[model samples]
Target chain A: MDSVRALTLIVTMAFLVLAMPAEVALGHGVELSVAPHESIEVNAAYEAGEPMAGAQVAVFAPGEPAEPWLRGSVDEEGRFFFVPDSDRPGTWEVQVRQAGHGGIVRIEVEPAGVVEVTGGGLTPLQKALMAACVLWGSIGTALYFKRRAV
Target chain B: MIGIRTTRMVVLLVTLLAGILTFAGCAAEGAPEPETPAPAAETSDTGLLVFAADGEEHAREGTVSKEGWNITFEHAYVTLADIAAYQTDPPYDVDADGWDLAYDHMVSLPGEFTIDLADPASDPAILGEVADAPAGFYNAFSWHMVRAASGPAEGNSIVFIGTAEKDGETVDFTLRFDQELAYQGGEYIGDVRKGILDAGGEAEAEMTFHFDHFFGRADKDADDPLNTDALGFDPLAALATDGVVDVSLGDLKESLSAEDYARLEDILVHFGHIGENHCIAEPLE
Candidate 1:
């Protein structure tokens, strides 16, 4: 009876060893998608090409409360929609966590007909001033040396 | 004569052009109206410092004997500070007891200089030129003697190294002075001194340190002596020739005689100043 019990235990251990890899592979497959609209729509999925339904998500914006600007779970199709406050502009941070893994992404809010001045390019006034200084220096140097030689 | 006149004409033209350009530059920058210019007058300026070993002009590299030992100075560098103000005549007197020169309103040159006292052909090292300096007769002036920051004697300000021979015995001696010459109000005084400086004209101060003046006298008690007696033999001079004596004063303190040690201390403190008749201010021409 003791030998039979030991054989049964060995069989059960082999079965568990063979099953662990498949479980890990299934858990690791994650994908995210967002749809563009007046309100942002977020979508998450796994590598098996299946939607990750009910995955938790949080959103934050500049000057928003620390306790997540918004929090919810993905819908049946692994998607969520967020309508940012009308006053909110600039960058929005979104965090998604499910099971044992998590990730974050940023969204930018730029209005139409608005432009940013990076200040990396030179202005017309600055270019003119530089040219004038170079010309003045060249003339002064040539005349001074000519006078000295004579 | 024609060349000289042409050069003068060119100089005047350049000056006029420079004046116009200066005004134009200020106007372009939207500067306010220019202030009234000062009246034409003479100004006292520090032009240069002339070095001589003894009374012989430009004799920087030579030997002088004290008692029986030969002495030579290889390098001498110093810094000159601004002159103290005197509201009344007979401006200030030298205080022999201690440093009583008021340090207030003292101005210093930008960088310390090592004048080439060993080269007779070399022009005196530049001290500084002050264009806006006051023009007048200065009663007295003060300066500082400092150690070199780098080179052979890296930290030493005064280096006098040479060979001394006596009684058919020759020995090497070195006096690497690291002590700073602090400015005292009345130390190293020159007599009947009046330096006239003119405005826009170059002038320089000449300070000649007579190496011969240092050796013949020794006083055992004073830190600095106003004068040294020729009759008294300075022990430092004797020790340089004698193998039994050491040149490092700090380590060989017990080996030196009381009088020799005192004289060495005095020389260390007061030997570098521009002594009487040795310092002067004159026009650059």
Candidate 2:
């Protein structure tokens, strides 16, 4: 009877071990392509070692709109691309989610480079001073001429 | 005569006004405006980022095997391929076209450093330093990994030997991650931000590499999990005192099924640079 009990115990333990689930490593990653004033491209993937298609994507800008600035999904190759509005120039937070897994990437857009037009002209201050000089000269001449005549 | 004198005074005043206007215009056009101030020169190092290998200090050392299995390494090493700096702020031009901008701020070790992932106190190697990093902060860093060849520690980039025991039976095997795949032509890790590396002052950071995640289960696609069950014997178990299962890095193609090779390749490509905090800087903490 004891031998039978031991055998039953061993069989039960083996069945339980076999029933245990396999250890699948949860792997998810993201890649980004960003440039000044250009569309930001992102690629996301899961552990099957393939691109994550149809993943939801959301973008957050610097200001209001507690809601996301842009929303979309990844294409067949698991890629998403979008251009930020011209007005929004700063750090943009991008979040991608799918199948209970997600990742975020922060992209920074620079303010446009400005080209100054010096044109080699007088500044506003210089122009104002020149006008004042002309007025003073005209008034002094009138007073001198009137005084001399009297 | 008085009218004539008045006329003469009027003409003189008009002439004087015109002369003054002309002189002012000339001065405005000729004199250059004061130029904007250049950023201050970078002096002194406040932040330092160092690379290390250990179980505790350098690589992930110890008997941290999965349930019902044990793994050990006879020799494990990874040759660093390239480490470059990226601008943390706008214009985010990676490596600044060349090192001259952010890459060459402070001189770095010219060649690669071969490190053992088993040792805990393997002295950390220096990558690069910031001189007078630009006015804005350097918020991000990126690196690439390459298989080592033509180095003192020749042969495979990674080598492993171990054994696993389960259900009252033990098996031995060997594994090697020698082949380096061309992901976008090279194994490139993306930009990672730790913290700010200011222009001046000594800010030190250290990075350690962890290895167990390479063998973790890949995400599931079907009803049951995949790549989680091990072979009858342990492929990573070290060689026995006499002779045991010896599986070299190049033997995977013939010894394992195509699905297994593909899975291994996936682990190779996505070797967890950001995930599992393998290539992380200490300043982040």
Candidate 3:
């Protein structure tokens, strides 16, 4: 009877595992969902065609209509996260990629805003001045040497 | 003819003597010597800081402050040595006297609209944060609000801040100072790190040890002096070597007091970078 009960428990455990859907276990193949925490989830795994286990993920936050924030790689399953906790808010982005799988996603966080400041980096005139000075110095040195030789 | 030959021989001997003297002088000149100043204070502004760090490698020309660092860049790099405002011995022994309230850290640059955005009256976006910038900031003259050491933002006011621009970016970076001496429940982002409170009955204040990077790390190198608490680093070696750039002290001093000056000075001395200097080959507005 004890051996029968043990056998019954093992069979029941195997049956329960088989009963659960792949979505619950492996997540319907790495789809995305938005949660109330202002976060996006990407259920991930070792995708087909390649191992897809340990790929590096780098996130470049969306520039427009978004807050610039970055987060990479979820847990062992392959999901990642990005939370807009800063006072500066806008559209935020989270990107996840590993080995040979995954992709990028864009999310918009609202209300708290940012001032987009745009200006010339290094002006052409400044670069020109520096170049001209070096050029003039070279020319002057050549001229000085010519005169001294004479 | 005898007189002529005598003059020629005498002239020859004199010339030989002079030539020997010149050669000896050259040898003396080649010996190692200390730096000599330009008679007119070096009007030749290289716009670089080759000599810094106690004037050992470079002589500082511009006034370096939170607003900007101006150096006579005869060379390619600036050597900035850390300067400390206060020094105290180990453990809380009564023998250990507190740092005197000299207020060594002072900074005042010329800018018009001063705002305590940390104040409820105004709420300016922390522009520096979005820029992936350091924790400190400076208000452009006539643009952002400059914090007042005495007036509205005195002691515990929060406002919009930023420095100038150089190399296509803002010069005023933020120093994530912990102002425990001046605010309730700590008016700083100390939740990420440890800090100390200045004793002043009720009017307390605090400071972040060095410039806080975007990833929330202090710039102090591994050998940073502060421990885990009382304004220290986690690993202590990551003190940032990159200092603020762009604004000059003389320009900043245009609107600062002795106290404000000292406070700014002290803060930079502890947390500023050595290789920091600013240059805008671009047109100045």
Candidate 4:
């Protein structure tokens, strides 16, 4: 009875395996496309596609392969966008990796040439001043003109 | 006269001040800075739209046009190894069912280019209407389908990739798939059955049909010029990756001339779809 039972189990296992289609899991998928010149700020990352989150980005100049030109983390949108050439020139390759993960994506970075972030990020005070100038100037001029008309 | 001039000056100054304030407030709202000959960057309005069907992202389109149909397909279950770039896996795995799909389209949201539907017979329901897409999302409101033809109808599915610009501005563009057949139920297919039946009820077992995606200068750099063989986009070529796709396209491809085939293929190759796994079928009947 034991021998017969064992045979039955083996056959069932074989059959099930045969009936099942090959299941291939997708690895990390990355695409390389030229972002518009203005939206060139970007980051390249690599990670095992599973967890679907928490990947870090490291960009390096292609061929140089030593130190990364830029490094950062994948945002909530799984993206890391920085000025492509923070004002420098060289073919770059951005790679993203996360801790406790395996999967590396290497993408080509054509020379974006150069870019300089001249404007400091908006400061609250500066913003307020610009607003006041436009608002108050217009209001004051309008009042003065109205009074004259009257 | 001098007093009147002084008063007029006062009024103009007041108007200028008010206008400045209102405009400044708007500026404070953080509208995109006007284009200032941005340094040689890819493009700010430029972005990446990934069409993932089956289990992989086989094709990557860098840009899309707003005036015409932008399609993407992820041939999963179907044996489609010969279809596009990177024939790295078996065409289809029948055992594992999937959310695999064949196409995705992202028409520009704030489509501003006016298009003249040369065909008066186009479905009037969606004609000549400007679309308002929310910022940060594709907005040319659309409807898509993918139906089954063998035994019973299967539900087709579609999703908007993202919106983009047609020109620097807004306009209406219409395309029709009638005069041949329509693909609405997810408009996805996995076989060339249509081609077999078309070959005099013994169709060529290959699917063929015209595919169109109008382009501006930018799209030409992104699309497969080979698909636009006639270059002028004459009678478009019908293609088949499976017998079912062929069966569905009917004789529409035959309607196109060799010159037309040449023209379309020329333009399509620029967008990636090139070579034999994807072909311009001889109008066999």
Candidate 5:
């Protein structure tokens, strides 16, 4: 009886191995899928317009400003591209450094896929004040010149 | 005719005033709302945020200068004041905004600190720490390198007492700079990220000084931009008397060549940094 049971078990194990798929047996199979993603491309250059080739790049995601969410180096053209996680929708910072010079650029990404680059330009109030000053100065200068001519 | 001219002038003034008021109103309406103050962190959630000053390995364990003078420092003293850190919503950009930093929360280490960067006891000499700092990423930093009132760096913003040797010649040097400078920098950029304070944890924001910028690196090529821009020890070594070179910024300006003096001034302006990230330094008024 023991001999019969051992022969049966051996036959079952052989059948299972023979029934396994060739790809599963070899274990070299791969799967692929394609999808669209929103990516940001940064071009870093010096004041002289020289490309910062091979410059180190660090990307900081929204709310996690201290750590680099992704790190890479720019290509020969001083360009680096990365697809940020859509789930983290806020201001994304990209820092580029080469040799001893570096700069940081901030991009605002909305949940709805709207992207905008924020700048440090003058505020509207500041612009208004500047314009007011210019106009007042012009007027004052014209009045002064008119009085002098008189 | 005179009455008519007066009336016209009054009308013109009224029109200008009205236009100015209209522009101001429009601008006020379009301006961004000021950020609300960040909510106070829970006592258990708050953490310590340490501020430190680092002169890099060049200050701690000295290396050869661009001119091939092997230099080692005995003391590199820098006096710092008004050191503050911020958690900016849209991280500050030093290049774009200059020193204008906007933040939701800020922690300041109030007081003057004189630190020796070359001291082997602490690689980065700790300036101070805010024990209950809010738990967040302090991304922007600013500080002033002011002349120390009293200490090893008294009467000077920076004082480097070191030795330089090359080609069988050695000089003991003491270089002092009196120019008061203010530096504003963004996030720390290096092999390790910094300024992230977690709940019940500690974090650090570093004020890094690149001494290599002052005495160029011999490891780098002579034609490298850093080496080319640096005012190497050779210039100071040339001014040594009996193997001792001690000078202040004023002394160097009067003794060294005009070109070398200018390079020295330029190096001081670009000395302050956040790790590898550069800061905009302006002479403090």
Candidate 6:
């Protein structure tokens, strides 16, 4: 009777072990790690200093200015963050709009993760004036030399 | 012999001076050639760019003014000229650049277009289109509101013939503006993006006008800047005579209160827009 009872107990234990999930029986575990990356952050606000909270945001890449590279909305603090594709390097345009008021900003991204906020460099009139100055300088130099030679 | 020698020397000096001037002229002309950069890319790929003007639902569906007047338009005529679209490498920022738009490429629609904003058929009247426009994103737009040469809106840059009603009183108004105004704007700010033309594809660039900027909106808070800055219908209604108000800028200058007149002029300057985006407006001089 003792021998028969021991055999029954062993069989029950074997059934329980067989029914257990593979992962649970194996005692699987997870691991985590962290790394550093580059990103861009922008803040939008009204002229009166009020935050444009929940504003629509659109990011245009240099290669495809016609299509939005990324679309999102600003946080309650009117802050937005994005990591541009480093492969595409050139002018990146970000537009933020809330209600009927909004504006666009430009960021120059280098191939090496360098980001720069650029401003309007020169107007056409300014460029023309600069060209005129160079032309005049060349002419004046030539005339001065000619007069001296004469 | 001395006189002969002097003449020879004078002639030699003159010849030398002429030669030097010619050389200087040539140098001046050639110096700027290298400064002008060639276009970044050129392709045979082309598309159609349709230039459109929108008055928005405020004109088509009618709107209630901040002053409680429900206004409906019969005819809203705007005569437009020199409508142009541009593609700027860095993209144009109206706030930063104002009227100074530096463009890499530009497409223009020739001739003057007098469009009726209240036309039930077309909410945004099609001003014109440019065929074979280089496929690109046109990020900047500029146009002039000039007096129509001969049309329903002749002798005026803009004509608004409409009806305004408030509290049992109704007023039919015809407000004409002859001020030649120029508007320079950046990208369109609306639900969907605009001005993106692909190779062999069609695209549109819009010239949007917000009448709510002039009349104010009842839907928005009265304290809202748009409403506060607006020259509401109340002021114009006060200038009505026998249930009608037909006035021009000149007429309003004489009839409306000085403060109200100044506000109206300021409102006119703020009238032009690109979707919800405001533009830099200047007299077309």
For candidate 2 chain B, which ten residues in a row score worst on lDDT? Answer: B182-191
Please give the clash total of every predicted structure, in order. 10, 27, 65, 107, 0, 0
True contacts kept of each: 0.00, 0.00, 0.00, 0.00, 0.34, 0.26
RMSD (CA, Å), each prediction: 34.7, 23.9, 30.1, 28.1, 23.3, 22.8
DockQ of all models, two decimals each: 0.00, 0.02, 0.01, 0.01, 0.13, 0.10
Residue-wise C-alpha lDDT for candidate 6, range A1-150, written one tens digit per residue? 111000000000000113323333333564333322355666665554456678788888987766789999988877787777878898887777765666676666775543345432233553454445434534554564586479
TM-score, every prediction: 0.40, 0.43, 0.16, 0.19, 0.72, 0.72
**Cα misplacement distance, residue B15 of candidate 3 (Å):** 99
Model 6 Cα shift for residue B9 (angstroms): 63
Error of 1 at A12 (Å): 99
TM-score of chain A of 6: 0.57
lDDT of 2 by residue, B84-153 (tens): 4333323232212222233323322245656665544454434445444432233233444455676534
Distance from true position, residue A110, model 6, in Å?
3.5
Model 6: chain B TM-score relative to the native chain B: 0.83
Identify the runs in model 5 with alpha carbons over 4 angstroms from their true place. Answer: A1-38, A111-114, A119-150, B1-45
DockQ of model 6 vs. true complex: 0.10
Put down candidate 1 lDDT per residue, A1-150, tens digits, no spaces.
111000000000000112122223335585433332244555554423345467577776745523478888878876766766647676564555442223333444454201111110113453354345434434554564586479
lDDT by residue (tens digit), candidate 5, B1-285: 999999999999999999999879978889667569987765576799999999888899997899899999999999999999999866786755777899988999999998999888647898889999998888899999999999889999999999999999999999999999999888887777889898899999899998888888888778666787788988898899999999999999999899988888888888898987777788997
| Deviating ranges (above 4 Å) for candidate 6 | A1-39, A85-88, A111-114, A119-150, B1-43
The runs of at least 3 residues in candidate 1 whose Cα sits more than 4 Å from the true structure, single-residue gaps closed, are A1-150, B1-63, B76-90, B95-107, B121-125, B166-168, B185-194, B217-246, B252-254, B275-285
Model 2 per-residue lDDT tens digits across residues A12-104: 000011222233333464333322223445555543435557867777675532357878888887777766665767666555554323445
Question: How much is B3 displaced in model 4, in angstroms?
Answer: 99
Write model 4 residue lDDT over A3-99, tens digit each, in one string: 1000000000000112222343446664433322322333222211122245555555544444566666666645555444434454444444332
Question: What overall lDDT goes with each candidate model?
Answer: 0.42, 0.42, 0.26, 0.27, 0.77, 0.75
Model 2 clash tally, residue pairs: 27
Winner on DockQ (2 vs 5): 5
